[model samples]
Target: MRRWHALLWLLGLLALAGCTRMDLAYRNLDTLIPWTLDDYLDMNREQKHWFEDRLAEHLRWHCQTQLPGYLPWLDRFEQGVAERSLDDRALRTLTDEAEQAAAAVAVQITPSAVELLQQLNDQQVSDLKVAFAKDIAKRHAEKVAPPLEEQIQKRAGNMIKRLEPWLGDLHPQQLAAVQSWARQLGEHDRIALEARARWQRALLEALAHRREPGFDTRVAQLLQRRDSLWPAAYKEERARSEAAARQLTLELLRLSDADQRGQLIERLQHLRERFASLRCLN
Candidate 1:
């Protein structure tokens, strides 16, 4: 009986190991080039939905599988920050990971688009590359020119404008409270923007130094470090944003009329259900 029980335990351990391996493989596959809105725009309605569903499913799987790996590192970083024990090495390591993760994901996704482009004639592929390059340049300009804080304030102001009509029958005080919440969101956005910029700068710097010997090895090291850090940073930031969202939702619910609140809740629920239904293609 003891031997049988030991055999069962060993089988269970093998099953768990298999599950972890499967999850890691799924993440690696999912992180391979994300399908953008532009990819779906050329498709028929049904095709567009199908593509979106597949894209979302893959992205969700990637997040679920990869994010857990970084949590311990991030928790340590956060704790260090809280305790004022943060060191340059820790910050640099985190920054390096963020840059590498971004690049790795980009590289993974790029092949899919490249494959699609291969099906096109030379001229068509050239045109597509040109268009893509132009978009990238424009984005680069925006990134370089915008003071992260100002850009965030502009976006927050825009969100407030968008939400104003939905905020029904609020007293002056309540309206002011909502505006205050918007300002807080703007502040959060600025922090995120700064973080993104720091990561981008790190990546660019690494690329600039790529002519040195062992460049590929260095690049691999950076990405491996990032793979260890980025997901946890992402999760920490997401949790903070979600907490704010819950707080805002509660405040909005209090200020909104019964009908408006119900309508908002219903709309949110429907959207959530729609998102949940998305699946990635095999």
Candidate 2:
């Protein structure tokens, strides 16, 4: 959201900022909407008003329809944690389902995105291209410019930070396992960014043809067919990354103590309750 344009953010809305802030952010969508527009494009006053209104409807649909579905997903995942039965297969299933949820949200908003994009004038389109280039440059600097060892350590640190919220402080073995996992995924960030570059280029090309026939179909394929759109190297890297992550997860769960598992269960339960308590249709 910080880097992408408004439409790009909408297409990738499933990447919530944090595990703990999910409910608060969802409930305050209006306040959060401005982040998507910042430094990305120059939507005029009328266009901004229109997009905001349409975005509201989309969020409402998500709250009322999409979120309920997640409760069950969390249920299954929490059960896996409680039962300590989350092998690689279970992890893969959960990951696949999460991707499907992301696809659903992307597909739902693509029409609105298409409509708004077709309204952009020539100058706005030029600004968008510049913004896209800037986004890639920023990502490259942050992700690819770092030395290999530094990137690996930073990646490990981030993984620990995310897991600590749910798993509590990792002991020596779990910490080592996490670091090993990160080391195994060497150069992953670079691979991911290359795929992102391809995706961004594809979007711009499709946008260039926004006024032509079959433009919507092209955009739809871009958003919904993510794995297909990815370059072959990216696809291979993704598979490797997922396999490594699942193995690391399985190992960590095996190494976790009762207290850590209990903490994880508590976090999942809290998330479920938080989601269920929200009044969506107001």
Candidate 3:
């Protein structure tokens, strides 16, 4: 289930909030899953048809029900952005709502996931394990295997890239804040990788007993409540990371010039309009 979890992040807040191609991405949600699953599961034709039907149903429910809630949430975020008052509390509130939104998607998809997963042969399971190993290795090389200083610099650079789209080019003070935040994160990239690897291990273990009783429950936990798989250090580091992100946001906003704030408001408005205009594509 964690195989599709990245889509939860990629298709939701991160995509909607940052990507220039949000509309295209949102429109492709129905097809995204089958494509993403190719990395983990190579389904037979009948299984693919069955999953497509379920995915279509889930997509309809999401477009009809879940997406409406996002409009109000985006409005709230835009309100704070326009007012130049996105405090830590407001940011945390939005983050919590985003987590809830992701959980809902996971809940909706779990039944389909469980049904399809239970049908996988042992060869498919072995392939999944191999796929996971490759993914973890690639992620580690990209994010965790780097020297600490290099990682910090790349992290800051990436933050600047994401922020510039919404906040415009950051002031020097804002750039400094970003660097500080990145440095403060220290070994967090490693912690995040460890947590993800732990989750995958837990998932593979669960799959070994996929036909046993309580399998659905195990998949639900794996899908919906992955925090239980986190190392204790990861949990603590996650809190620190969130706090650093909030502080960085506050610093960036405080340092932003009037033009940057204006650009931010305009961008948020454009994003809201774009999302609002996305019809429920079948």
lDDT of 2: 0.74
TM-scores for every predicted model: 0.37, 0.88, 0.89
Q: What TM-score does structure 1 among the candidates reach?
A: 0.37
Report clashes for each candidate as comma-separated counts: 3, 0, 0
Report the Cα lDDT for residue 72, model 1: 48
Mark the 10 consecutive residues where model 1 has the least summed lDDT.
Answer: 1-10
Candidate 3 lDDT over 123-148, as tens digits, reads: 99999999999999999999989899
How would you encode candidate 2's per-residue C-alpha lDDT over 1-282 as one tens digit per residue? Answer: 222322223212221113434434444554323224446787899888888788788778877877787788778877888998887777777677766766677788778777877888888888888987998899889878999899989988887887788788999999899899889999999999988788878977888889999998987887677678988899999888878877887888899899998998897798788778878833
CA-lDDT, candidates in order = 0.43, 0.74, 0.74
Tens digits of per-residue lDDT for model 1, 1-282: 011011111111111121132223333343233334252124346544655565665466445553343344445533443344444455445545544554555444343333332234445434544554564456555543567566555655554554544443455655565566555654454344444444434444544444455555444444334333244556566446544544554454455565654544343344334333435211
